[model samples]
Target: MLDLTTHWAGILSVIIFLSAYVLVVFEEVTHLRKSKPVMLAAGLIWMLIGIAYTVAGHGHETREFAAHIIEEYGELFLFLLVAITYVNTLEERRGFQVLRAKLVGLGLGYRGLFVLTGALAFVLSGILDNLTTALVMGTVILALGSESKRFVTLGCISVVVASNAGGAFTPFGDITTLMVWQKGKLEFLDFFAIFLPSLVNWLVPAGIMYFAVPQGRPTPQHERVRAKPGTLGVAVLFALTIVTAVSFKNFLHLPPALGMMLGLGYLQIWAYFLKRNGARRSDEDMVLDSFSQIQRVEWDTLLFFFGIIFAVGGLGVMGYLALASELLYADLGPTYANIIVGALSAVVDNIPLMFAVLTMDPDMSHGQWLLITLTCGVGGSMLSIGSAAGVALMGQAKDGYTFLSHLRWTWAIGLGYVAAVGTHLLVNAATF
Candidate 1:
């Protein structure tokens, strides 16, 4: 409605978005919640856009913009909602705990255990969020290797790298990949294109770190945890949910969230009967207490995304993204531009970067899209603070796996990143 392409509105949008991001990055020092600033930025950016529309006698355009955000972003929100909910349901059922217990019981020697842990993190991170995967596996490594601090430290590093690398190959593996998938830039099947590269991304550094793990076997102090009544059923249902989500997207011409929410319904029904016949009646049961699980849906994360996505959307409408597109892709060429984007992801958060790229809406081959996804996903491991996996591991194993400890291995991880990109260029050359 209004030509705010060159209007002050565009400049204002960038300022608000960046300011909010700075607060988020330093949230620890500030002792303030990152979501607070970003959420405010979203509201302010939208208000600025409304004022711009009013100035040009196009105030009605504000509603259309809001509708567009709701329709597009809402789909992503719902899809994540179902996935997160299913994961939380598993958490309630102690599926992760059970899996952790079984892993520890493998009676693996130190090097064998190291490989097992890294491999599990890689595969699980492809299905679970990388942060969660790293946290869980990092715990196992620290626990079993507690007598040997050096082994624990190196193992923590492997977990972070493996989690980040594993996340690069799947749609649900990392938030950046999810954004790429939700944007329709890459299809469900398109992710398989990078599977080998992602595997190399994990295995290369893992191979390097293998010698670091001592040759002794693990003496795990096993916990006395019992599986919940319906744990297996819920896990089966969770797997079904994932399959349904993929089916909906590939065959039904609908947002995968629709299929996932329906799967949630199946989980609910199973939960109901499990509760009806079971002896334990704790409220954490997903079916017996459905609202309880819904309440645990990481609202802070979802809200943080709400603000970030809306703010990024405002910038897209304001035209700064086009300027970026011209400078990065048009002038620099797609290959170099994408490679640089991946590099920046190490220092800067890739959430806003990927969202901005999605908003910029550049046109490129499918191969180029997968390349950026791999880069952004793996690049985050270059610094311990660069990714959720690294940051979470730092917190979980602070005694030895500090920021400096992780940084000590940056070169190796960085090499893995380069190899992954190279592999993509060679193996998926046709897509590019």
Candidate 2:
């Protein structure tokens, strides 16, 4: 590792990664696909590393490193495949619509509705995913707001904060947290330990923005749709999937992905039953077939994740992460360094940041690991481009939810970020 920095490949790796990441962050504005550059860089970085090691008379090291990368990331890629496919299965069947109707039908006043909506985003993102939670909640807000710009704008910001915050306490919440979970740095129930601070992260922003919600009843939406068969079943099975994954990892010492993939099989069986049943079904039900649901999975996101793992793995092989850990954690201290990294996640991509940190293999207590996880997971709410939930909302609520629009409320969100970090430190004092 000593000569890694002196080698030309190390410098080339850094330049390629930086250039690729710049385009990835500004991908929306540039109309350049984020996956393309990252995928290209992933290959190039590995190629450079392989070349360097071979030339240095350590060709065997290249094979070992490549295998390890594939083993770790392949598990993660499959884990997300099942999770994302489950979400798509629900969405394609309008399960989210049913959930949305339940919230909307509560008949609360505008202020009350806004509060509940934010609360729902928090809880729902933990189960259904941050991006989908934002989409469902965003649609509800826009419909409830009845074209009121203030309500739509304010609600969008709250949803983004709540979504990011809620995602921190669950394994399947955000990509960063998921990476940590899959990396074996944290266990399943360990995530729930941070639920309190995650709640605070959401509530602070929601409380601050509560005043902006308009008064009186929303313009009632037209007829709400009924929940379809298998919708409730899907929800129940997802819960079972969580339980199975946890039990397998904690007791049987099996990879949690085994449970997740099994759950997908259950969904596929149910879809097969639907296919054979002698009954008419809507187009939504038709998509319940495994083939259609699989087709709907977010391949771009999965590919982006693949590239990040490989690219960062290459840097790890070059000992770049060792340099980062020494400078940021050893020199500056883990606490402040982690907080700063978490804050940077608002502007940069958290996936690579977390991956890099894991590669560094910092010598921190579980408390410290949990702390960084909470900060990185929730910090994405500081700006619209800070998170997938925020980015998706920007696309869906195109007119009102711009990055600048989110910036206007960053003070409130930033306050929540600080408060959440403080709460984590206080509550998890034992671990530190």
Candidate 3:
């Protein structure tokens, strides 16, 4: 029947989304398969299926889908490439090592390290993503070792919570926020409207963990490495790249990718010159190793994201999103709907959920949209697998962190989640 065909397309879109999520989870749990390739394959599969349905029934051109994918997501891909390149370059130069040495040198007791590391991860995540923040902090914790297992676990959980909470305030901090921004669903500074609430999300859990952490003796001071002679140059170059990228985004109306690409090129050139300019053997070696570290970048996450975008795009094309939006809005209403959506983000990827919401175009005031953004952004800390920080920490520090270990912190996260929502409602009520 004609009706059946329409419904089938919608069903296929959901199936594709679910399938990609399964692959992502499987990759995380098994570690037997690579996620990037699997994600790419899944994306292509859904794209093909979408094309088949569109062409067969709707008389849509296949090229239109491809064009849509490029036009809509091209900048995102570029931003990913550039961001990855920058992260890889800094990681290669031991950017994080400097921080690690400082933390260890603080001679902080186990409790101090736990609190400090968690706070740092939370703050840093506002600038970088939660995953990178977690990776850097988690690595530091791992370096600290089992002598501080309790502290390390507490620190990791705090970092996960803080990172997710902090990420909600910025456009670049989380994928869901970024997707929503890209779709013109929200503005950049508008996110800060809920900043107080977002901060509360981390503070609540962090405060709890602060008390939960056991006191221990201070760690012995570790030897500090002198900054390489050209460290300043590398740092400057890095700053310039970021500045240029931001300039492109704000002033030029260019895609975020343009800045990232320019930055990547600059780093490569800077590294080449540094290598050629009689740089010390140690500095040169560090730079070389840093370059190599790019290989370790999680390509799987990127591919998985790509697949999800396409699958969701397919759903958008099918008109199912509109109907689903109507049903959800009617049944849940915006206030409870926002909470339910945020909670669901713990199990499902918030990126697609954000996309689905964008498709829905709920008629809401700016404050309400801000609430949605804040809740979804901070809500990811609810579970270890809920956000990038959790997943990345799990993968990079598998020896120490497990899903169950993260689950132990759920009560703390839940408290934070509730506090964040409550704070947002209070702030909104007072303001409006």
Candidate 4:
């Protein structure tokens, strides 16, 4: 392997990534998409690597590494695209809105709604990504009691914490978990081992914040929203799609993306039936076009993933990640080092942090791998800016769940974080 630890290309690549990341962190203030700077940095860094390695007469090795990175990004991209497409289809069918309406109609007390939304986020995020889970449950909380600032604040915090925690226990839940799974570090069922710890992570903070919820039912929301035709079928297809993906990975020993793409066909066929039925109905109740939902996938986020992978892969090829692995994993050891990785994730995006860890390819046990997965998944909840769920909720409920509001509860969240780590150490000690 080529070592570019002291190479000028390595130094310049570091500068480019850090500068782009600064823009990413300040994206709200700058009114710029997080994808733009990183995309540009990925291109520039890779271009430099191509040139440097080619001149050094290691063009073949460089090409092989670049191809490997491309393959990695491709699998993740297709899988997420399919997942987002399913989510968009559900949204179009009023699946989420109907749930929100039902919750609001229940007229649960502030505390009840808080626990319910948090719990739903915790469970739903295991199937859907944390961002979607947070958004859905956050909307429910807003509708359930938008007038109560106290309720909204507490509810938003809980949703963020729960969504991140829930995503930790399932491969489909968060980008970090998916990376670990796709890397073949753990089997599909192995992720469930952390479910208890993930639950404790959310429950601790929720129990502490429960008392602070305002008392009384939210203002009555009497709106009668209904699901579109084929809602149930679409949901079933989504479930089947997930099963197919897992089966492909676990049974067929194939790339999960292949199953996800194949599942896209199931949705298309279902959409055809809906369109044909809607044409016969005067009210156009079943008139969804699945292609439109495909267009609604979060392209910016997908692009951001592409850029981060390549950029980090470039650094890995330059030998920076190896140095990091030796310093963090080798010197501090996996337990402390993994804890620090999780803490750092509270400030940085967990995607890149996990990607860097994967790139480093440190030698660790199955329990240590699970430890990193749990930490990266939930660590982002310590601050509103730490996770996509928190950031989206901040935008969705601007006046209620501001950065300071979340920061105020950081101590409680931090306590939950520690408890989660301790619980895993105690309960999963046999695995270690």
Each model's C-alpha lDDT?
0.82, 0.85, 0.72, 0.93
Question: Best to worst by TM-score, what's the order?
Answer: 4, 2, 1, 3
lDDT of 4 by residue, 1-432 (tens): 678779888799999999999999999889899899999999999888988888899877777888999999999999999999999999999999898888888877899999999999999999998999999998888777667999999999999999999999999999999999999999999999999999999999999999999888777777789899999998999999999999999999999999999999999999998898889775487987999999998899999999899988888988999999999999999999999999999999999999999999899998999999999999999999999999999999999999999999999999999999999999999989
lDDT of 1 by residue, 1-432 (tens): 444667888777778888998998888789777779999999999999988888878888689878887777788788888888777877787778887787777777778878888888889998888988898898788768877788888888888888988898899999899889877889987898899998888778788888877888768566756676677887788789888988988888778889889988987888678777653554443334555678899777788888888888887777667878999999998888888888888788788788877777788888999988988888888888888788778878877788888788888887888888899999999887
Q: Output the better candidate (1/3) by TM-score.
A: 1
Candidate 3's error at 13, in angstroms? 4.6
**RMSDs, each prediction?**
2.2, 1.8, 3.3, 1.0
Instruction: Give lDDT tens digits, candidate 2, residues 250-302.
Output: 89888888888888888888787666551555444443576777888878888
lDDT-better candidate, 1 vs 2: 2
* TM-score for all models, in order of appearance: 0.94, 0.96, 0.87, 0.98
What is the overall TM-score of model 2 with all chains considered together?
0.96
Report the lDDT tens digits of candidate 3 across residue range 241-340: 7677667767887765687778877777776776766455554453443355456666766766676666666665556666667677777788888888
- Specify the poorest-scoring 10-residue window by lDDT in model 3: 1-10
Q: Which segments of model 3 are wrong by more than 4 Å?
A: 1-6, 32-57, 226-229, 279-283, 286-296, 396-400, 428-432
Instruction: Name the top lDDT candidate.
Output: 4
Off by over 4 Å in 1: 1-6, 279-288
lDDT, model 4, position 230: 94
